[model samples]
Target: MILIVASLCVQILCAIHVIRSSRNQIWLLFIMLFSLLGCFAYLMLEVLPQHWNNRHVRTARAQVVGKVDPERAVRDAQRNLDLAETAANYIALGDAQAIRHRYADAESAYRKALAMGPGGDWGTQVKMAGVLFERGESAEALRLLDAAPELGMGSERDRRALLRARILADLGRAAEARLLFEDVIERIAGEEARCHYVAFLLQQGDRYRARSILEEVERRAKRMDLTQRAAQADMYRWAGEQLAELRKV
Candidate 1:
């Protein structure tokens, strides 16, 4: 009831803004028809541009759009590839498809990028390896990781390590997986590394340690704003589910 009322309130507010500010009337129709998503569009695209130019807001708006209309990205990427059959375009399409969980399509796209010689770069190799991992080709994924040159630091390094750790875990190399997870958790700041570690710990039957780490996740979450919390909502929900299951035994 409360959420519905808030939704209606926001829609009304955006409609008024569209009229008063002499913005496009199409936005008014959107607010009336699509509800909260419409309001979000107005606020992020129209209102924010006119009032603020914060970096965080821009990122948040992109993430929101991706969440609300994931397929639009895939379509855009596909269209780009259609217009110019370039290696970069294939990569863009592959990434878009991968985010939508279309692993096979992503693999195909990445493979094409690889066969293009110059486009068959190391970065594309890493991305193709990841999609292969998602497709359950764990051994091939590991091979690709093994073949890549050293990535010393940054998000790409962390991502590679994380993917390697998950692959190792799936391959029954628990010791190797644990070491990689421990190494990456110390380097990364986000909830994802910790959450992945917790899952690995639970799989190893170290429920005590898993619970402890999850409690840390909860503690960190308490310091975040609603948007930050929403970004990791699935992780928190999974942590809750794990905690509940742990209690059963």
Candidate 2:
């Protein structure tokens, strides 16, 4: 009896998900006609794949993989690069190498992408700048970002602004960096950006402003559901640690 009740519940939930998802009429027919197996199949094949593709789920899966083989990402990226030498694949290889702190390898991959692709490759340039910045080549990072074609609106622009700000900060151009950081924060208000800005403020001896910014990030993060928080786990953890350190001060 319990099994029958649970199966019925599954079918109802699957039907609701199908309706919400606008899946094909065939799936609805399958759910209606094939009973328990149909509902289970639909949940396994359809609903779960959608959930798994979510950013948080992908991050969690990557974390699990990272634990097992720290170098797996670099290896997988190389295999993909071997299969397809496209600009996109090279970018992926660069990102994977960057994660492993292989900045020289990452820089080479990004440069290859730029050389292989046509002119005005904004993404490749920006990625190369990131690797340069991480490797403490701040002057090169600034030059790359400045020379790249004007990234059009939205996230691309904000990303370039943030990187430029960081490079400026590293180069002792505090006023310029502060303005750029403020503009980026006003535009996107992303956690990573806020945390970075807070660090900048602290470095500049503005603890009050840093504390306020950190508080805002903490409040926003606390309000997110588990999945949303997990998607931003790295930034969230950074913000949390920064906030804790600030409180201690």
Candidate 3:
């Protein structure tokens, strides 16, 4: 009886050692089931010899090289105009990809441009945010859009605000998005913004306001020539489509 108890105690110690040494759950379970033989087999075959040496190598490498900074790399790319231009082309292609719902490719292209540090280039940044939003990274898109105000003045800011508002609407923050759309309309009076704002109001069930806005946009577009009117007509057509689709739902 004493010998049996001693063997059991030895087996328990070996099992504990095996559990500590390896992360394999199956091995641990086996050791628990047939303690003596299982523990011995695990020690001999599973517990890695020279594990400390491997850990030392990894530690030494980490000491020599620290974490990579993506933003720093982007800054370096920004210093080279040629690279930045190439990144711009990539962003354009990304827009095309996004229209086709090729979200992965769109994301890859946008990230490449972002990595090029398109600093002060709000257009590229907004395009990147659009790709991110389409790819279901709406939170990150919002962050990028929110950073747009710091970039500078121009159409980029307007476009970024519009994109951000659209994302906010998608996330069901309609009230906040409506305020943003209204602000955008006030800052930049354009057929596109009017259309988007009207569509947004329509989505929120403000049909009367939406119709009023659409009528105003139509009246403004009618005073323009073929080229400008065609562009404005496109906005009205898109707005009409949005309204039709919403009603179907």
True-structure lDDT of candidate 1: 0.87
**Predicted candidate 1 versus true structure: per-residue lDDT over 15-118, tens digit per residue:** 98899999999999889999998899889888877645554455567678888887999999989989999889999999999989999999999988888766
Worst 10 residues of 3 by lDDT: 64-73
Clashes in each model (backbone N, CA, C under 3 Å)? 0, 0, 0
TM-score of the candidate numbered 2? 0.76
Using lDDT, rank the candidates from best to worst: 1, 2, 3
Report each candidate's C-alpha RMSD, comma-separated, in the order given.
Answer: 7.5, 4.8, 21.6
Which digits, one per residue and each the tens of the lDDT, describe model 2 over residues 1-249?
Answer: 999888788778888888888987688889878888898788788778889888777877777788789899888888998998898889899999998899999999999988999978877888899999999999999988888887568887898899899999999999999999988998874587888899899899998899889899888877877867765677788878877888999
Output the better candidate (1/3) by TM-score: 1
lDDT of 2: 0.86
> Given candidate 1, what's the lDDT at residue 84?
92
Error (Å) of candidate 2 at residue 121 is: 1.6
Deviation in Å, model 1, residue 207 alpha carbon: 0.3
